[model samples]
Target: MAVKIYGIKNCDTMAKARHWLEARGVEAVFHDYKALSIGQDVLEGWADRIGWQKLINTSGTTFRKLPDEDRADLDEAKALRLMQAQPSMIRRPILDTGDQLIAGFKPDIYENVFK
Candidate 1:
């Protein structure tokens, strides 16, 4: 796959990431979770590369709102299912650089990775 930035457009962090990439003139395909559907296979591939722990957005409200039981005892399969069911539960701006899978945004990390 080519470089893709998977995120929700309205997300503040996503906005920052977009601006960062735009300022750098880095071309990337955007996968807006709110505007389009993310396939199970896609999420699975991401999980394989990044690990389900990093892929899941535990900091987000969607994940916090889930029942304790639902969030409990999560493995790759369970986390993948939850993320597939609620795309918002996936970390914002997962940057696929066509070589590596970045699960979340960090300017320094981005700098090093993209540089």
Candidate 2:
């Protein structure tokens, strides 16, 4: 199946991922999470496949900007709610290669998976 990359268009990592896929001539369907809000079921499905921990980008500004209470004692349900509300809280370039769900952009990982 073709790759479906879930990320914002302006993200630097997303740019690299797009370039890498284009260079390899791989078909990529970019699901811009900003433009297209991900459904709860769809997001939950990803979490089920990869785990909610992987879906939440703790290092991103979105997560950091959260109220201290939100960040202090987080759990799966709370994290999922936050991510659903703000896609930016999700890690960049979540790759869906049909069989697996990859949460972030890693050149070496992408090369190994797709090449």
Candidate 3:
């Protein structure tokens, strides 16, 4: 199966990840959740594989700007709602190799994935 990348099209990290894959001749289809909304089922599947905690981009401005009440007491359902409402709150460049899910862009990890 082909590699599938999920992220916002204009994200710098997404660009880096795409460039890295292209440089190595790795073909991947990018899913820009910003333009197209992500489904709850898809998000749930990812969460099951990598854990919901890893799916949320707590370090991003979207997350930081959230009211303390909304940010506090996070659980799978709450996190999913937050992410669905604001895709930017989700992490960038989530690489799905069909067999595994890789969150974020780490050169070494990506190299290992290709290898």
Candidate 4:
């Protein structure tokens, strides 16, 4: 299975996820969003899979720093555009294993999905 992991390289959760995969001898292609931008279609696909709430990182500083109006009533299209413009607004450690798409990195979830 070809596993592709997407996130910012310096993110703590992403680092932990990478370490977990490495320790388990799982080889995954890492796609750093900052370095390689994701297009609107891809973002939409992810949102469709995980839902807007799951894809959007409202807890992150990037989202919190946005103007109140910007965060006020964001729909799917708007959220996708925002995430495309600022990849950090998306949740970290999105894993694509051909057949499945996993967003975020909880060890238990990773263990269950990746295994």
Candidate 5:
């Protein structure tokens, strides 16, 4: 399967994920969403597959720094707008493994997916 790992390059989680993939010899392409913005349609598609709640990284500094108004009463539309404006607020290292979208880095999960 063609795997694509999407995230900001500087993120710590992303670094770990990349390292793990490399160590495992998993051939995957890295997409720097910070430099090249992720599209609204693409985000929408991901949201469709796995709800916006999972795609968003509320615990991250980017999201925590967001104004109270932006964080309040989130729906798909509002969340998408926030994510589009600040890609960093979207969770780190979303691995697209052709057949599935995996959010965040977990060794067990990666092993299962690749195996």
Candidate 6:
């Protein structure tokens, strides 16, 4: 299967997910959003697949640093635009497994999808 994981290298969750995949011998391409910018098309696709709430990482420092005005009243279009501008505002370890897309890493979810 063709699998690609997107996130920053230093992120703890990203590190864990990468380690998990490596331990299980699952090959995947890694896309560091910090180095490789995420475009509107890709952000929109992820939003469509998982919805804006799931795509946006409100818990991240990037999101917290945003102005209150920017964070308020978010819709799909606005969220996509913001994510395009600040890739770190999006959730980490977004996995594109050809057949499906998985956001965030959970042991049970990873096992079910990858194993």
Q: Best candidate, lDDT-wise?
A: 3
Give the alpha carbon lDDT tens digit for every residue of 39-109 in model 3.
99999999999999999999999999999999999999999999999999889989999998999999999
What ranges in model 5 sit over 4 Å off? none
The ten-residue window of minimal lDDT in model 5 covers 1-10
Question: How far in Å is the alpha carbon of 35 misplaced in model 2?
Answer: 1.5
Q: Which is better, 1 or 5, measured by TM-score?
A: 5
User: Between prediction 1 and prediction 4, which has the larger lDDT?
Assistant: 4
Q: How many backbone clashes does candidate 5 have?
A: 0
Which candidate gets the maximum TM-score versus the true structure?
3
Write model 1 residue lDDT over 10-110, tens digit each, in one string. 99999999899889888889989867968999998987887889989888899999999998998889988898888999898899988888988899988
Model 6 scores a TM of 0.95
Q: Estimate each model's TM-score.
A: 0.94, 0.95, 0.98, 0.95, 0.96, 0.95
Give the backbone clash total of model 1: 0
Candidate 1 segments whose C-alpha is farther than 4 A from its true place: none
Residue 21 in candidate 5, Cα distance off native in Å: 0.8
In the range 1-115, model 4's lDDT, one tens digit per residue, is 6899999989999999999999998899999997889878889888888787788899899999999999988898888888999999889889999888888998998798766
Off by over 4 Å in 2: none
What C-alpha lDDT does candidate 4 achieve relative to the native structure?
Answer: 0.90
Please give the distance, in angstroms, between residue 73's alpha carbon in candidate 4 and its true position after superposition.
0.6
Candidate 5 local Cα displacement, residue 57, angstroms: 0.5
- Model 4 bad stretches (over 4 Å): none
